[model samples]
Target chain A: MNEQMTQKPYVIGLDLGGTNSVFGIVDARGDIKATTAIKTGGHTTPESYVDACMEVLLPVIEQVGGLDKIKAMGIGAPNGNYYNGTIEFAPNLPWAHDTVVPLAQMFSERLGGIPVGLTNDANAAAMGEMVYGVARGMKDFIVITLGTGVGSGIVVNGQVVYGHDGFAGELGHVTMVRGAEGRLCGCGRTGCLETYCSATGVARTARELLQNTDRPSLLRELDTESITSLDVSIAAEKGDELAKEIYDFTGKMLGEACADFAAFSSPEAFIFFGGMTKAGELIMKPIREAYEAHVMKPFRGKAQFLVSGLDGASAAVLGASAIGWELK
Target chain B: MNEQMTQKPYVIGLDLGGTNSVFGIVDARGDIKATTAIKTGGHTTPESYVDACMEVLLPVIEQVGGLDKIKAMGIGAPNGNYYNGTIEFAPNLPWAHDTVVPLAQMFSERLGGIPVGLTNDANAAAMGEMVYGVARGMKDFIVITLGTGVGSGIVVNGQVVYGHDGFAGELGHVTMVRGAEGRLCGCGRTGCLETYCSATGVARTARELLQNTDRPSLLRELDTESITSLDVSIAAEKGDELAKEIYDFTGKMLGEACADFAAFSSPEAFIFFGGMTKAGELIMKPIREAYEAHVMKPFRGKAQFLVSGLDGASAAVLGASAIGWELK
Candidate 1:
């Protein structure tokens, strides 16, 4: 075998989301040479989902010079376990909802024994940031993904922290509130950071505020039960008092949580990812202010607050592919 | 030089505290061959304090076959910085309270230029456990020190996480309760875990419980203003209901904190150290119960709760000495 031919110049990324399995062939510089997608939840089983994925993915791989030119594949999925390369009990995925799917091995086998790596999506984002985004050259930092659920990827001494069971850095689940009166989380717990800082959490807060107050605002024009974070952002953009207050409350809690996280790892930076960051200074200002106010004296003013530098459309796929580059 | 002489068989340990500085010469098996002590806060200057420490430590070093037999030295002190080997702004140490002291370098210079390492006491305990006690062969664990102030040392992937600024693992300061009604901590924070679970916090709990409730207990006979954790332990031993309740509150908070910690590192064990662990099952049971009750689903039933296996009198010294072994 020629060493040059075997040293593949590209890798594949699979961003396995609840609704879409987005695939991209990426190079060392994070360029997407070819991309494709499949409906993730439409498949009846894990095997069928992989079959559908391969059908869409094959042409994309061919566009990038076929199998010999692809070094590996990496998947970023909900409940993905890096150690075993399995997707376990991912509630949002129809194919992997109730059982552990050996997705990495399946992909590897179907791809002529090419190596495949898997990890929770947030960790992938962290790896992406380190490889090609804002967190480049940082040895210790945390990447927070704020979407339907809040997620975190922690880096320490330049390596992702995967604790004893291949499951660590679940910062979103840390209780931000203790005792009976706290908000209930989907994780069967009360007062998780996810309950207060997630995109869903923001909508929940908006609904609560809308129902509890008599204030006239742009959000009142929308159906309160169907309100989304996008709606909140639009409302806030129109200078709605109530919507702005909601961001304030959300950002404050998130900043406080980051303060606690600082006490844990003392990262050089905290990189925020996902839709909520699109709110920009409206959200970022409050997060930075609250973090500085709540963090311990030694840690205050030391950590940078950054947004994901990767292009929003391609970041997740790029992140997954970055993990592919790390495969041994 | 002969390899035997260059690879000296002993290490020196300094357990520098607010009130006293304890020194020990230890062999490879964690045995304390000789020991000495000196007043820590008595000196008006760091120079005088080092002078007093050396006055007592030299004889002990001589008894262990002189400085030539010592490979390195490690100091576990308040505000000790592992990267710089200095004590920085330690409020309890008179000489080090307002300034950073290069104690490690001073010791090395005075003691024939042997390598010296230093870190906060809790980190030292973690090193001790990894080298000579219960945490042997474990790559991920946390050691919580429950003394006048609560402190922590977090190990992930077989290395202590020092963070970006060498002040990570300040778990005691993480908020247990949010908002106005929480207790004030010495660090000027409110609702810190140290405010609820430290040895001092135990005494404070006893005072509050005694003052708030009218129920009669053996603690009422003691001067409330002067009560100590030892008093609470004694009362609990005699089956005092109020004292037992105090342990329940402290242990529950600690357990809950450990649960949060699990979310961070998913450590295999949570080890308790310091005077409070001496209460044994009185404290351990509540911590275990609360941890099991509050830990996230993935982490539940996965961690062990343990007390320090090293002897109380020598553990701190042993822990400090273990860091010496890691010195290059």
Candidate 2:
């Protein structure tokens, strides 16, 4: 067989994060051949970001058989909206204004009208999971990213529920408690689900334990100032009772959060992704137990909680590419 | 202005409640011209229940041209699934076990194979609102029915979010509070959204107040057994502080629930229905204030909270008929 005939054609996938931009040349089968990274610079202008994205994707396209075989470019960023072809007010990515035009439009402008498409990184991960991961055969499930903050990518009836303004499926900001003394959230509120259950949430809980409660664990071995969610996970793996309790606590909150989400969406399962989800069963057991205990009876046995099978970095690129694949 | 030409084509709408069943013939624009009601017969047998529903709808439908001109029969039931054409395990209507198709088919056989579509009352209410009420011009909003128990139907990007098992949008049973105390829900859970914010929820709050706190109000003047949700609303209107507090508390919880839902579905507004929603500004003010305070900044000034214009009896038929409109 001729190597060139057997080889699959490539598309460019862009991952636009808060600080850096990651781009890759990927084939239909999700094989990443050429990759590049660039700083997003500051809130200078949308033109600068567009220039930066083109500069990064063009080189990768050139490296992998020039621009002709690069069928399309798929861009995935935080707050990306597929409907209006823009990203609306992402706090983390300090862009100059509220909405940014289709990263697809920018790609086509540079590449002489090649096809382009866009979606959020979280949503892209969901598409990636559908195309190439554990949820490959499933139509209903939630992809939860336990990153800097908790993010949800909901899939029901084989499509994402991007609501009226393309800002649907935000499950992290649900209220766990309401009165005073509920912890302050990053969004300047009290008792947000992300305030208690995400990695930053776990670290905050550990800090609170050191400051208020007298729990014995390896977590207390370090100064409260330096304790990390990783230390808590490590201690839990070593059979530290307090660490186990902490994980159980985190899992319990997440379980209840998943239950609430289950009530509204009635998904088949919830797939976990991002950093803190690495704790695995230590965090899963409590979540499952509480979820069953608290969920509506009909929804009790319907949803499963599991970790994602896609590599974090590769998943976003593949997810973005899936958008291009869908459109193409 | 002859009533003949403008007397739009009527479709038979059947509303199956927990205790009673009502049937009405509705014109194209949701005007209910004729209606009839019957007591729901004994429980624990599909034979009796199906007979009751058939008896309820058959006569009223016959009054309007013998079901020939009736485009379709739309039934608003509890736990009805639009996908499999079944109603599975409704708590209020417990005896209905996989009885949707048999009943619809039975009716269809009698009516010359006219289409019969069955869906849950909440979802039907959503259709009613979209087709006839406050949401008539909008494609995205959540319709919350604040009755004996809270119920919700969600619309996103011009479609409903029916989950993998056809049980999505059970918004009433979500665990809005983490670990709340008090009476258990019909589903054997504690702290459901309905447990705290429904008409029954308001009564629970009033009783708790009568037991726990010492404050002076017209509530004290009323007989304990005779106190009702209406008395509470009236008392609050008459400058009674305790009644005002009860409404304020319910409104607060409701607002928080809205903010949480906003994070999940990002609807443009919420349309309220059922008897309890008549509390009007007593409920609307607090919900709006809290939702504005708690929702994500981007979604902050985007969604509205409004009253349902659909009559209580007509809600069922209009909601179910909307599905036919959606499918057509």
Residues A1-328 of candidate 2 have per-residue lDDT tens digits of 7655653377778877877788878887778889988886664667787777676677778788787677777778877887766766676766634656555676678887878877788888787777667787888889988877888888877777777888787788877877797889877888888898888889888888778878677877788887778889999999998888888888888888888898888888899888787887888789899888778777878787888888866777777776666665
lDDT of 2: 0.78
List candidate 2 stretches off by more than 4 Å. A1-10, A42-44, A62-71, A89-102, B1-10, B42-68, B91-102, B180-183
Candidate 2 is graded, for docking, as: medium
Candidates 1 onward: DockQ, in order: 0.82, 0.66
The DockQ for candidate 2, computed on C-alphas, is: 0.66
The global C-alpha lDDT for each of the candidates, from Candidate 1 onward, is 0.92, 0.78
Alpha-carbon error at A199 in model 1, in Å?
A: 1.1
Superposition error at A92 for model 1 (Å): 2.2
Q: B1-328 in candidate 1: lDDT tens per residue?
A: 7756576889999999887788889988898889899877779998898888889888888887788899999999989888899999998887888999999999998899999999999999999999899999999999999999899999999998999888998999999988898899998889999999999999999999999999888999999999999899999999999999999999999999999999889999999999999899999999999999999999999999999988998999999999999988
Q: In model 1, which regions exceed 4 Å deviation? A: A1-7, B1-6, B51-68
Highest DockQ: give the candidate number: 1
Question: Per-chain TM-score of chain B, candidate 1?
Answer: 0.96
Alpha carbon lDDT at B220, candidate 2:
86
B33 Cα displacement, candidate 2 (Å): 5.1
- The candidate scoring highest on lDDT is 1
